[model samples]
Target: MKLVVGLGNPDREYRDTYHNIGFNAVDILAARLDAPAFAYDKKSNAELADVALGGKVLLCKPQTYMNLSGDSVGYLSRYYKIDMRDIIVLYDDIDIAKGVVRARLDGSAGTHNGMRDIVSKLGGTGFARVRIGTGFKPNYMSLADYVLSHFSSGERDLLKAACEAACDFTEKWIKGEDWQELTVTVAR
Candidate 1:
């Protein structure tokens, strides 16, 4: 089984924040797949849906909040008996340029506490991941405050488009498209 985990805070207040782009991307994927709406899974402490993405696919949004996201991801991984390599995590990255999406097999957590927690819980950094760029936090703005800020009306359009492009790349990956031939760049 394939697992895709989206990292973000669960509270309603964080729904549209830049840091919650991971959640937004997951929602877009679910909508595109025409899967049932995500429902809270108490056992997993996450919002979840199982859809057919060329096969069985488990989509999850950990409700444990961002920093402690590993708690939920670890639970689902152990419970489902899924191999670490089959798991794909989606999260925002401030270091990457705005309107870009990157995919990698494995990497360090960088400055993302959520990813750091996941690496700690899972005992390593072997899982696949997609890092959606939210752009660097402006010099005048603190990283935490900027990540929690809501996107502007104009920026919303760009983010929405980015989500779609990211979803397309994910779908292609799922369908066995050659990874080396894949290219997804959204900068509008």
Candidate 2:
């Protein structure tokens, strides 16, 4: 089974925030697949859903919070006996411009605490990740507050487009498309 984990805080207040873009992307995928409703999984600290696409089974997780994402991912990954290579993490990145999506087979956590925790628990950075840019905030604002805040109207539109592109990239990945081609196609 392939696992697609979307990292974000779980709370009504975070519903439309930039940090929740990962969760939004997962929701888009689930919707496109006509997947069943998500059920709360205490062990994973996430909302879990299973969907079949192009003959592959996908396990989706919207982790409870950014910092604690690793706990959920680690539990589910081990439970399903899935390799880190079969897992893909989706999250927001402030370093890139809005409406952009970048994919990497493996890398350091960068500035994302969520990715850091996942690497710490997984024992390495051998998993794939899709990053959706949310644009950077001013130095005066706290990172936590900036990510948790709602996007401006313009940003929201750009975010929506990026999420759609992310879904397309995911579909290509599932089809065994080359990463270079997938990245180039999605970047457009």
Candidate 3:
């Protein structure tokens, strides 16, 4: 089984925020695969769905919230007996340019608190991460406010494209393609 987690705050208020890019990507993936509706699972503290692809069961989770994401991820990971290598995390990256996607096999959380919490609970950064760039916010706005803010009209179109690209790269990654090749293909 492969576990694909999208990190985001789960609330109506966070629906279209920059921090919810992960959720956006997962939605695209689910739509592409015609996956079933996501229902909230109390035990996992996430909206969960399941689908089969490439002979492996794919478990999707849009965690409860960014700060408490590890709770759901750890729960699902343990329940499914999935190894770190079979896990993929998708989230927004402020450092990269908008409309771009980056994939990494394993790495520190960098500046993302959600990733940090996941690493802490999982005991390591041995899983894969797909980062969809949201672009940097202006210095005038606090990081919290910036991340929770909605994307501008112009940014929305770019974000939509980026989300689709992220989903495509995710499918490739799950299929055991080279990380570099996936990145290069999405970067094009």
Candidate 4:
């Protein structure tokens, strides 16, 4: 089974924040795939849903908030016996400009605290990941505050379009299409 985890803070207040782009992408993917509704899984502290896509695909959104995301991902990885290679993590990247999406089969966690925690718990960087661009933080604001800030209406539209592209990218990846060959950016 392949596991897909989206990293984000779990709370209504954080739902529309730039940092929640990962959660947004998974939600769009679930709808596009006609996947069943996600249910809270206490064991993993995540919301999960299963869908058939050539094989079983487990979609996950950790409920442990961003910094502690590893708590949920690590537990689920062990419980499901999912290899790091079969796991795909989606999260926001402030380093990329908005409307850009990037994917890698394996990589370092970089500046994302959530990814850092996940990498620490998993003990390796061998996993697929898709990063949604949230754009760089303004120099006047702190990183934490900027990430948690809500997007403007214009930015929201751009992000939604980017999320749709990410879902398409993810679908192709699951169906054995080469990820590098897929388009990774949405026209702005």
Candidate 5:
């Protein structure tokens, strides 16, 4: 079985924040599949849903918040006996442009604290990743404030489109498509 993890904080206030793009993307994907709605799992501390592609795939949205995301991830992964290689994490990337997504088979956490904790807890970086771009941080803004802030009305369209693209990217990925063959970045 493959696991797709969408990293995000859980709460109504965080619903539309740039940091919650992961959750947004996962919700899109789940809807596309008409998969069961996400339900909170006490053991995983995450919202869980299952969809079938090549096999049963678990869609996870970590509810431990962004920084402590590893706690939920580690628990689920261990419980599922999922291999590191079969895990895919989707989250926001500040360094890339808003319409772009960077895919990789393995890598460092970079600047995402959630990813950092995930890598640290998992003890490896062999998992796949789909970094949904949130654009670069402005010189005048603090990273925390920026990520937690809502997008402009104009940017909302871009984000919604990006979320769709991310779902497509994820579906193709879990269906065994070649990573390099997928659209690395899709821009309007």
Candidate 6:
């Protein structure tokens, strides 16, 4: 079985925020794949949707917020006995330009607190990752405030396209296709 996890806060207020891009990506993928509605699981503290993508795949949206995302990921991974190599995480990256989607097979978490926590819990960085860019934070705003802010109307379309591209990238990963060097950048 393969696991695809999206990292974000669980609050309604975070629905369209920059930090919630991971959740947005998974939602789009689920819809495109005709996956069933996500059901909340108390033990995992996440919303899960099982979909068949080349095989049995579990799409997860962790509800432990950004900083503590590792709790849900670790529990679910251990419970499912999923290999670290078969796991993939999707999340937002402020360092890249907005509307860009990038994939990496294995690496350190960098500056994302959610990814950092997940890495810490998993005790390894062998899993894959897909990052949706939310653009760099402005010099005037704090990182926390910027990440929590919602995307502008103009950027919304770009984000939607980016999410779709992320879904394609994820599909490639699930199918064991070449996805390591793929980078998708939406037109402005």
Can you give the TM-score per candidate against the true fold?
0.94, 0.92, 0.93, 0.96, 0.95, 0.98
lDDT by residue (tens digit), candidate 1, 48-131 = 999987889999999998999999999988998888878888888898877888887778999999999999998898887788
Whole-model alpha-carbon lDDT for candidate 2:
0.81
lDDT by residue (tens digit), candidate 4, 39-150: 9999999999999999999999999999999888899899989989888888899998999988888889999999999999999999888888999999999999999999
Candidate whose TM-score is highest: 6
Off by over 4 Å in 2: 181-188
Worst 10 residues of 6 by lDDT: 178-187
Q: How large an RMSD does model 4 have? A: 1.2
Error of 6 at 132 (Å): 0.7
Question: What's the CA error at residue 66 for candidate 3, in Å?
Answer: 0.4
* Local accuracy of candidate 3 as per-residue lDDT tens digits, 1-188: 88888888888889889999999899899998888999888888888888888856465564557987888888888887889989999999898778878888898899999999899888899999999988898899999999999987867878888899888878887788876534522332
Q: Order of all candidates by lDDT, from best down to worst?
A: 6, 4, 5, 1, 3, 2
RMSD of 3: 2.0
- How does each model score on lDDT? 0.86, 0.81, 0.84, 0.89, 0.89, 0.93
**Over all chains combined, what TM-score does candidate 6 have?**
0.98
Q: Look at candidate 5 and tell me the lDDT of residue 61.
A: 96
- Residues 48-151 of candidate 2 have per-residue lDDT tens digits of 88877765556566454788788888888898888998888888998877777888878889999999989988889998888888888879999888888898
| Model 1 ranges with Cα > 4 A deviation | 180-183
Q: Residue 148 of model 2: what lDDT?
A: 89
Clashing pairs in 5: none
Q: Write the per-residue lDDT of candidate 6 for residues 12-65, one digit (tens) a residue.
A: 999899999999999998998899999999999999999887889999999999
Which residue pairs collide in model 2, if any? none
- Over 4 Å off, model 3: 180-188
Per-candidate Cα RMSD to the true structure, in Å, reads 1.5, 2.1, 2.0, 1.2, 1.3, 0.8
Better TM-score candidate (5, 6): 6
Better of 4 and 6 by TM-score: 6
